[model samples]
Target: MLEYVKTILQKVSFNAYLFERELKKGMRYLMPTELEEFKDWCYATFGMSHQPILNRYFRPAY
Candidate 1:
C-alpha cells in the first residue's frame, strides 16, 4: 500500500486531483494504523491542504 501511494505520488507530483481520489478509493484496504501513517506521510509530503481533503474521504460522514 505504501508502495502504491509512492507510485501515485511519483507519477503525478500532485498535479492531478486523481491522486487524491485514488487514495480515497484505495483506502478501504488500509488498517487504521496504516491510514494514520498514510495521513501523516501525506501531509508531510504534500502539505496541510491534504488534511481536509483526505480527512473528508477518511471520514466522509463527519
Candidate 2:
C-alpha cells in the first residue's frame, strides 16, 4: 500500500493539486504506524517541491 501510494505521488507530482489530493487519499488508506513512515518519506521525497502542502497536512496537531 505504501509503495502504491509512492507510485501515485510520483505520477502526480507534476500537479500540486493532484499531489495533495493523492496525499490526502493516501493518508486515509495508510495505518497510523505507516503515517509516521509516510510522513518521513513524503518530506524526503517531496519536501522541496511541496513543502507547504506536506507541512499543512503532516504538522503535529495540538
* Top lDDT hit: 2
User: Runs in model 2 with CA error above 4 Å?
Assistant: none
| Residue pairs in collision within model 1 | none
TM-score of each: 0.60, 0.93
| Root-mean-square deviation (CA) per prediction | 3.3, 1.3
How much lDDT does candidate 2 score?
A: 0.95
Candidate 1: worst-modelled 10 consecutive residues by lDDT? 53-62
Predict model 1's lDDT versus the native: 0.66
The residue-level lDDT of candidate 1 at 47 comes to 62
lDDT (C-alpha) at residue 7 in model 2: 96
Consecutive 10-residue window with the lowest summed lDDT within model 2: 30-39
Write model 2 residue lDDT over 1-62, tens digit each, in one string.
99899999999999999999999999999988899999999999999999999999998769
Question: How far does residue 5 in candidate 2 sit from its true spot (Å)?
Answer: 0.6
